[model samples]
Target: MDQKIIKVITGQRRVGKSYLLFQLIRLIQEREPAANIIYINKEDLEFSFIKTAEDLNKYVLANKVEGTKTYVFIDEIQDIENFGTALRSLLLKEDLDLYCTGSNANLLSGDIAGHLSGRYVEIEVYSLAYPEFLAFHKLAENNKSLDKYLKYGGLPYLIHLELEDEVVFEYLKNIYSSIVYRDIINRYSVRNTTFLEQLVLFLAAHTGSIFSAKKISDFLKSQRVNMAPNQVQTYIQHLVNAFLIHKVARYDLVGKRLFEIGEKYYFENLGIRNGLWGYRLEDRGKIMENVVYNHLLFKGYKVQVGILGNKEVDFIAEKDGEKLYVQVALTINNPDTLEREFGNLKNIPDNYPKKVVTMETFSGNTVEGIEAQDLRSFLLA
Candidate 1:
């Protein structure tokens, strides 16, 4: 289906959306060479002239390739204003299979669907899931190698081990800047981007932890960079829009309550976060949780950071009639640590398949009624 359809691929930055689009185009070209594939990257300086719908129509006419199934591939198309209408017009009048890639979900939300109703399909792509990451880096499926993927995530371009750590960090830094400057600042006309940058750093430093914007504002205030709670909230939304951070709301299944009090965030790739800040093994739990979050999302589950009773489940995945309770920890370690993790699953008082995944151990057994499984095995399975 990924290759058969001409669809819009939306995902976080550096998550292989562009590359995936290119791959699909190549596949289509191999099948139908006479099928014209005109690729236009909106960020290109040559396409800078495409600011309005008229410009787009002219640009399309100038570069029009002749074929029965001409594949029109556009990348980062949100840069062009009123592009939705132009695309709608082209799709309506022409016999073209359209493929577009965007950095975020704005294309789906902001008038694109309304303008091009039932005209296109959307496919979401994500950063390398655990299995993909392992395959990309040619790493053995073991605790030690999975640890490396967790520490520095699987951004396809950075899979090479020969690249210096500093070089990788610099690349991530450039990506961070692109999201901040191009996606947020340029797209939203946000003033005083310093607060936004600080907010992202704060969120990245404390991923997987649930806290309110007011609490974050208070924390920022203590650092002498006092900003309003509303401002902090806006900054967080901006980051989420740019796809650098994902805010997961706490779902209280027992109480049947959806509270806006505390929300958790996960980075698109742990490598970028670890690169920006000094890496630490102590932060492995959040890194693993981030990996799992991306995995469940790519697997087509509606996932949430679960708040059940007094314990927090790392992920609550639901699809169709199935529900999964997940707990992510660095290791099953000693009895006490094991109890803490397994206890969270043990107390659920429901049979929804509880799992405790970690970097250690290959044994799969029932610990205190909670199924304990190694992270690598889960991915491979």
Candidate 2:
């Protein structure tokens, strides 16, 4: 609760970053009832005057109590100009426990990292994981719940909305617009809004598919949107920085190196993807793959696409110096489907927990030592 380093809680816009800050504030209040807490939310119009570093410092210092640890909480700190300078100054005070939330990942990767360096630790918040989704919706763990999860995705705010396509998708679409307009376009000063939206749509449509910037650019060109490969790359990076989508590099199983040319893009929230790009039965395989990737990430794994010669493994998740190979499929009902999903993981020589996840339920069966788990079981576990 009381740390000298700045706790930077970052995520996409409206992913409950502010709610998390409130939770932290609640925890602190419970722990220290008489603590001095200074809270500033830039999104709130009341804090509009606190725009610059001087404004921030003056407000915090003015509210500071003598000989006591002040827990400072700032929401959307990126709204403040030269926020790193204010944070750097505030961090020096032994009694001030600095904590701030940001919606942009670039806030850490760019100048802030240069200013704060080792003085700050980033906590990346994501959309509700599968378990959290079930709990939030007050739904029992079942196929129907899973379907709702896959269809709507795990945006925490979805709890208040009715789980209807018209209701949920509309809300999700609005959230998507906010993220694109405010986080991506406004933050990066993106010029070609049309190209950016098209790119996002393309990524959503082709989620879990591996391709390069040149490939994307050429494809867009075919669609009459002529953007250079470099520009396409820049817009994609902007999306990634905004935490709208994650770019998973293709890892070579044999060479033990990552491939630079091709990478898979998965949306941070599936509802946003489904809202923007209509949810279809035909795209279930890719949707399942995206769900698996998000779950792996939710469980704190560093995931990548694995390339084993001619075959492809959906995910290579690693955490705590340990590795786990995962292959996602809609169903392994067919012999060929089963072989491809299991065979790819079996090809991995290292015996570090290889498994296949699918929508179909199995009786704890293992295909040549590779486990098969239903999507719900995998997500919950």
Candidate 3:
């Protein structure tokens, strides 16, 4: 808050970016009772006239308080053309504390970088984490609560709706459409809308599976939807850019390098994935993996799929120069299941923490030095 740098809050649409801005504003108001706040929401028709950079500058300047510092908050700033230019000019004034929210990941890339490099900071927002889900729904931690979380996922607005398939999925499908049609298809001027939706369905069904673009292309060809690997890769990139899904690269644990070919994709919001593809009992394993990946990200870890020899580790999470190995499974009740999950981590050379997260609660269970954690406890941690 003391810095002059602009706080750029970025996230997927409906992931609570505006809510975050409102929270910040509330905090500022509590701290500074006389704070001069200039708020502009592009989503609201009231700000429709402020389309260009000059118009934005004029409005902020016109609304400026005489002597006090102005705390300016712009919602959906990406909606305005040449908004970086206005932000750059407004940033010059020592009296303005600028903050803005954007739904696109590229908000700070390309032209925006040229205008506000080193003059801003980015804070990414995501759908609610598991702990947040429990708190938001006011549900106690148990099988039922966890099941609801796994099925519905955590979009903050979901709190308003009854947690039922018909009602929640209806809302989630609409959000999926907005993200797909408005964010990716419209922004990228996508030509093959049919293939795009099909690709999303493919991703939803095969959530944690690792495959190359060529592999996906080949599979699509078999389905009679022919798209070249390059084009398929481009469309996938569009989905990633839109923050609809996260693309996790595969890392070779032995060679200590990232693999170029295969990668795994997980949804940014699981509810959206479940909404697009029905949440079924058979997909429990994939759902568990996706849930683990999202939780790792929520904990601010840089996560990647790990490959060591023939064994595959679910996640190799790194943060602040430290690493953590994680494996997710439906259960380790079967002896083979227990060994496979822990055995993969045992082969890892270094001494960083290794854990196995499962559906069944097993307290203080350790295999050779690896800790075993239940899904709910792992999420809370």
The prediction achieving the highest lDDT against the true structure is 3
- Per-candidate clash tally: 0, 0, 0
Candidates in order: C-alpha RMSD to true structure:
2.5, 1.1, 1.4
Write one digit per residue (lDDT tens) for candidate 1, span 60-159.
Answer: 7667765465677888888778888778777764556678888866778875777766767888777788788778878787777776777667778877
Model 1 ranges off by over 4 Å: 1-6, 61-67, 160-163, 362-364
Per-candidate local distance difference test: 0.78, 0.91, 0.92
Give the number of the best model, judged by TM-score: 2
lDDT, residue 126, candidate 1: 74
Off by over 4 Å in 2: none
Would you list the rank order by lDDT, best first?
A: 3, 2, 1
**Candidate number that wins on TM-score, 1 or 3:** 3
Q: How does residue 288 of candidate 1 score in lDDT?
A: 75
lDDT by residue for model 3 over 1-381, one digit each (tens)?
Answer: 857999999889999999889999999999998899999999899999999989999999999997889999999898788899999999999999999998777787754677888989989898999999999999998889999999999999999999999999999999999988888888789999999999999999999999899999999999999999999999999899788999999999999999999999999988899999999999999999999999999999999999999899999999999999999989888999988988899999999999999888887648988998989899998
Cα lDDT of model 1 overall?
A: 0.78
Off by over 4 Å in 3: none
Report the C-alpha displacement of residue 306, candidate 1, in angstroms: 1.6
Model 3: lowest-lDDT 10 consecutive positions = 105-114
The TM-score obtained by model 1 is 0.91
